[model samples]
Target chain A: MDVETLALVQQLYGAQSHYIDEGHAREWAATFTPDGEFHSPSYPAPVAGTEALTKFAADFARQDGVTRHVLTNVHVTPAAGGLTVRAYLQIVRTLPGGPPELLRQTTITDDLVRHAGTWRIRRRTVRRDDMKENR
Target chain B: MDVETLALVQQLYGAQSHYIDEGHAREWAATFTPDGEFHSPSYPAPVAGTEALTKFAADFARQDGVTRHVLTNVHVTPAAGGLTVRAYLQIVRTLPGGPPELLRQTTITDDLVRHAGTWRIRRRTVRRDDMKENR
Candidate 1:
């Protein structure tokens, strides 16, 4: 029943990875809803809405080197208004003339809804493995 | 077309990750064909056949830290007899008192075949991102 939905979810995630890794800030933010929420302990505060999300992506792109945002162990579940997707995310970064470093590891839970004939994240909650206060 | 096949492939990989991370050595190796092959630059020698593959997995379980084997950016292509799966592989490790470290990042190409009513890797080649001598 959700065969196609599963595929669409995977496609969106693949695109999200590319958008952030390549510094496509606006494109990355566009993956989320206009008032999407992003909550994480790593950030100074929870970022929500379109404008802030765009700025967050832009700021993330100012790193000193290459960054690969990898997602794995994905699971999708049907929800009331949309779909719920959860996956493990790893942030690997490589500095200039240095080796790639495993910067962060976390779990991302996203509530997705249909927007503009495609999937858009309505809210995303990230729980870092190293941090114990995800709640 | 490949909707079901891709899901099966993803499930197999997810199982593989757990088999290794949880130190189920034999179970991990069993995901490979009886005469499967695994070639990687990190290992001193290429491992092939059931006996060798089982041994390789067993040896890997002796690490002094916890390791997470992550696979992302998966792409599956239909093959003449089976399927070809390619993805980026990341190894994250954390010692008893240290933070998680990105140990290795590589590309893995696998030739998969149905064995005993389940998909099994017939051959796997790992190309480390830091190594250019993949040829």
Candidate 2:
């Protein structure tokens, strides 16, 4: 993708993370297309479509801590259907009366499609980094 | 700043992280101007100038593990002398035979200058998050 498109993709990420982090579940889910799919090792099963996506995000938001999704090192490529995006995702958390901590680091690969003049995720797969220890 | 300039600033972060992560200390130091300054809670003293910056990066490279600087949520503002850039800095590290983990998270603010047609850091200050726990 070109630089202008790259800038738009970056904004897509910023908006997605902001919505979820701020507990705006519906808005967060809207970051995806109507039939978007999410497949991640962190979840028990893949979630697809608007209703399911909303619930998935809402469940995470109901948790007892604040979580931030930090996306960096984004690389984008053009595809037949949309654009392929790969980025480093660092999840940071802070629980009640607890100090902020780095919860986990994962790589997120996404297929982003622009529908109705806006970019949204069509599919996303998150992979955890291989490590000798979990902590 | 405009979209194009924003794209350039993003490239600056990517290059800065890549050079240091790959152990190219001199090249990493060159990401800054000749009299650039770096201040961070992670370091005992502020380091300035090309010589000191190179040494600072080299010292970190001497460590046993591999470290990656993940920068996200970058914000840039135009200033009189240069551009003020701020971003979330997540430090992730992995030792030999150890799992990769998030070492720390901090906020980084930078003063960027265009010297000889390329962007370079004039000053960078990193601040740690207020955390009750440092693990």
Candidate 3:
């Protein structure tokens, strides 16, 4: 029954990892719903809507240094209006000839909804492992 | 159709985190098959079989500190004779009055098989985020 759902979920993660890691921010943002929310400790507040997401992706692409965001351990559970997905994310940053540094380790939880037979993230909350203050 | 399979995978991770964090070394080892193998950069070689796994867990449980092994982002895919599961793991350690420190961030991959109506890990691999040497 949920075989297809799980596959769809896999696609979501696959596309997300590929696009973001490869610096296709708009394409990565497109994996979310039009009004999807991306929240993290680095941000002052959640970035919402396609317009904001576009700008957010642009800013991310402008950051200095090479980064690879590795997403793993994706667990998806059916929810009332959609599905809840949780996974662990690690970002590695590197300079020329230098070993990769651990930039951030975060747990990401996403609320996904199937709209028009396509699964899209509705909200993504990122919780950093080394957060100093509670929000 | 695969809902239960994924849930069982989630259970494997949940049980692993709980048992290891709470110091139930033997119980944690039971999550693996009789001939299961656990490998990590920290280990000189793969810890093979239940006996070795038991000893490894025992030594881990003796470490001093309040530690939490937080597992997230679990992706489970069907494979020959079993399932391949991957996720991100973060270990947090805290001393009294000190901030929770990120001790380790690793990407874990486990090969699990269903035996006699139960799922058990066959081979588990750990890759750390900030390893200076490649193995």
Candidate 4:
């Protein structure tokens, strides 16, 4: 991938992280396409569509406190649709009366489309690894 | 990073994925540097060094079945010592009596160095998102 594409992917990741951390569920949901699919290995079913995703985010926001989502090892490939990006993420969640928990260690596989010149998630599947009990 | 570097990163991901899925734990563990640290957010402590990582992988190999790990959105930047790469991954694991599980969706952050002219992971950290119970 070129530098520009890499930068754009990073920007999209940053936006998603910001929305999630800031408790802007609606905005976070808007990061995807109208008929987007958000798949997480932990979830029984894939969260489909922008509206549904928005609602899910809203509910998730009711949790105790802040979270820091770190993205690394981002790989982007040019595709007919737009860009296929894969990233490994580390999410640290700090809740009330507890220390920050290393919530997940997994990879994000996503198909992003450029809508009006901005990258948005068209399909996302999250794979989780090493699920351990918190101390 | 240039094409050569990007290709190298992809190769590394493929190697790790192959070893993990095929139960070649010791070989998989050798992909890292001697003092390497494998950090998964879900784990309380990072898996350190080549030997320890090998043992850990060997144990993990006793699990059920085959897995397909897909890597996308790979971004690589030139670092002082070697290269830093970030990628999102989707790992699909299929066991004997169950359907394929999207094991994890996360980002992989790693520092890689050229040892004997070949890239090896010096350190790696995995972050996960959206944990849902499997059906």
Task: Please tell me how candidate 1 rates in CAPRI terms.
Answer: incorrect
Fnat for the candidates in order: 0.24, 0.28, 0.10, 0.00
User: B45-110 in candidate 1: lDDT tens per residue?
Assistant: 899998998888888878776677877778889897899999988888766445788788999999
- Lowest-lDDT window of 10 residues in candidate 2 chain B? B126-135
lDDT of 1 by residue, A8-63 (tens): 88789879989978889899999999999999888889999889999998898997
iRMSD, model 1, in Å:
3.2
Stretches off by above 4 angstroms in model 1 are: B11-67, B72-91, B95-97, B102-135
lDDT per residue for candidate 3 within B73-97, as digits (tens), equals 5656678988887676677888778
**B44-71 in candidate 4: lDDT tens per residue?**
7889987899888877767656454556
**What is the per-residue lDDT of model 2 for residues B53-74, given as tens digits with 9 covering 90 to 100?**
9998888888766677888788
Q: Which candidate is the best by lDDT?
A: 1
Interface RMSD of each: 3.2, 3.5, 5.5, 8.8
Q: Rank the candidates by DockQ, best first.
A: 2, 1, 3, 4
Residue A95 accuracy (lDDT) in model 3: 47
RMSD of each: 5.7, 6.2, 6.5, 10.5
For all candidates in order, the CA lDDT equals 0.83, 0.81, 0.77, 0.74
CAPRI-style class, candidate 3: incorrect
Candidate 4 scores a chain A TM-score of: 0.86
